[model samples]
Every structure is written in structure tokens, then in C-alpha cells.
Target: MDKLISEFDRALRTVFAPAASVRPHPDAQIDEPAMDIADKRHAAGLMRVNHCGEVCAQALYQGQALTARDPAAREALRSAAHEEVEHLAWTERRLQELGSHKSVLNPLWYAGSLAIGVTAGLVGDRWNLGFLAETERQVSAHLDAHLSKLPQADEKSRAIVRQMHADETAHAETAVALGAAPLPLPVRLAMRSMSKVMTGLSYRL
Candidate 1:
């Protein structure tokens, strides 16, 4: 009953909570790139996809946390969820700046991701961490691709992406340290392919 209530509370927060991005490292150095209008549009599209990823992150962590048997693993899921909130906040802020709205199917995305998270957790602890590590690793690579594609004049977005990329890298490292078993090559490839499809579709859809 407590777990059910907790899940319900998390769902409510995810749906109704208002968040403004909070920089944990207020003094961190940010480097901005310059990009033209064309590039900015492309960057915005890419950022939209990234924002969707963060939404999924929230649902993923919540679902995993709900089922995690290990206290430490549950705490880790919660910690990651907190960081995901910042990512969600920042991406929403950036989307507004770019004159864009979030994915029309955000609720769908969250539901699907939550299902994936819970399933991963039920499978095993190592698999759960493996999913997380795979996710962050893929996200980091996607950010790198965005860095290459973003407009040279769009310094603000670039700065945000750079910081996000760095943080994601750190997250992956932590997951590895937490005994994340590496996923098989085929699973990794399939994940990459799905991500590509998502980015391609969400860029304009």
C-alpha cells in the first residue's frame, strides 16, 4: 500500500509539478557555440528529442524505484530521478526559448518508459543497472551528435547540452561502479536504432 501510494504521488508530481531548472553547479563553466537560424532550428528539433528522453528518464526511475528490492539501489534510482528533474526543467526552458512545445505524446512516452523501467527492475538488479548505463551512454552520444549539428551561434543551447552531456557521462560511470552488467551487443544496437527513430520522428512530429 505504501509503495502504491508512493507511485501515485510520483505520477501526480510528474504530471502536475512545475519546475524551473536549477543548476547544482552554479559556478560551472559554460561554453556557448554560435549557430545560424537554420542550425538553430535543427538544434531545437534535436533538443525536443532530448527533452522527451528526460521525460522518459523520470518515468523510468520512478518505475524502477517502485520495485527495487535493494535499499541502496532504490536510493540510487531516486537520486537519478532527481537529476532527471533538472534535465526536464532545463529542456523545457530551452524548448520555450526556441519557440517550441514539448512532444504532443509526452504522456505516451512516459507510460511506455515506465513500463520498460519496471520490467527491467523485475528482471534483475544487474539488468536494471545495465539498462540505465545503456540509456546514459546512448544519450551522451546523441548529445555529441547534437553538438555537431547545432548552429554555431546558438551558444546557450550548446552550453546546456555540453553540461548535460558531462552529467550523463558521470551518471553512466556511477552505474558501472554500481555493478552494471554490460548489455549484449545486439541489445545495444537495437537501443541505438530505436533512439535514432525517436530522434528522427520527434524532430518534427
Candidate 2:
């Protein structure tokens, strides 16, 4: 019960934590101020999407980690969670710089994702890992698309998105190496469709 309570607390913190409480960016190279208003708005919008993704990541990892029985599988989930901390950090910093807000519906998003993760875990470890693999694959591709759409003048946002894309790809590959079963085409399509809804709603809402 204590372990579950601790994890629940962590999830709440990660999903809705104050931006000011997080640590400074590991690489502070992109901290310079810019005078472009349009560029800043564009960056803010993109950063909000990125922050939403991290919120979902926290819920997914926590749900899977809580239910996973195998030590190895749990470790993988934990490792992905750790990497997502960096993503959370980067997006938060970008939002702060751009003077934009994180999503107001973050707790709702987190709860939804956590339920999905728990459902996936109850199915079996392989299926849970399969879900992770497919999710990361889709997210990496989405980040790639975001890179193309981000305003050209927003070099800081571009850099952050590029690195994030690479990290997501790595996460997907790692899940595969850890024995993630290939998902059925129907499952993948369904996942993609649901993700599309989330991404679209998050982009402006």
C-alpha cells in the first residue's frame, strides 16, 4: 500500500508539478532570450504538446511499473520513466521561456493514460511491452512531423524536438530488444487513431 501510495504521489507530482520546482536544464545552451513574438508563440504551442506527451509518459510508465511482475520488465519501464523526466524538463523550460501554460487538463490526461496502461498491463507483460513499443514508435514519428511544422526561426524548439525524437526512437528500439511482441495491425491502427485524437486536442486545447 505504501509503495502504491508513493507511486501515486509521484505521478501526481510529475503530471501537475509546478514548473519552477523542476531543476535547470542539463544543457543551458538554449537559454538566450529572443525578441520574436510569433516565434515565441509557435514555440509555446509546440512545447505544450511536448509537455502533454510527457504527462502521458509518466502515467503509462507508472501504471506499467506498478503492475509488472518481472523485474526486468519493471526495470525497463522505470528506465523509460527516467528518460521521460528529461523530456518533461525540456518542455517545461521551453514553455517557461515562451510564457505559455502547461495543459489545464493534465490530471485528466494522466488519469486516462494510467487507466489505459493498467488495462494493457493486466493483459500480459508481452502485450504491455508491445503497447510501449508501438506507442514510442508512433510518438517518435509524430515528433518528426512536429519538427517539420515548427517555425524555422525557432532554433531552440527545433533542437529540443530533434533530441526528443531521437530519445523516443531509442525507447522504441529498447522495448523491441526487451522482447516486445509485434502488435497486430488492428491494434496498431487503433492506437494510432486514439493518439491522433489526443494530439489534435492537445495542440490547441
For all candidates in order, the CA lDDT equals 0.79, 0.82
Candidate 1 local lDDT, 1-205, one digit each (tens) = 9978888787766645655556753213544355566776787787888888888888888888777777777777788888888887777777777777777766777888899889889988888888888999999998898888877677777777888898888888888888888999998998888777777777886
Q: Model 2 over residues 19-120: C-alpha lDDT tens digits?
A: 332434543676555548876776687789888998898899888877877788888888888888888888887788778888877788899889988888
* Candidate 1 displacement at residue 148 in angstroms: 0.6
Best by lDDT: 2
- How far off is model 2, as Cα RMSD? 2.2
Once model 2 is optimally superposed onto the true structure by TM-score, how far is the C-alpha of residue 95 displaced, in angstroms? 0.4
Worst 10 residues of 1 by lDDT: 24-33
Error of 1 at 12 (Å): 4.4
Off by over 4 Å in 1: 15-17, 24-37
Q: What residue runs in model 2 are displaced by over 4 Å at the alpha carbon?
A: 19-27, 31-35
C-alpha RMSD in Å of predicted model 1 compared with the true structure = 2.7
Give the candidate number with the greatest TM-score: 2
lDDT of 2 at 142: 86
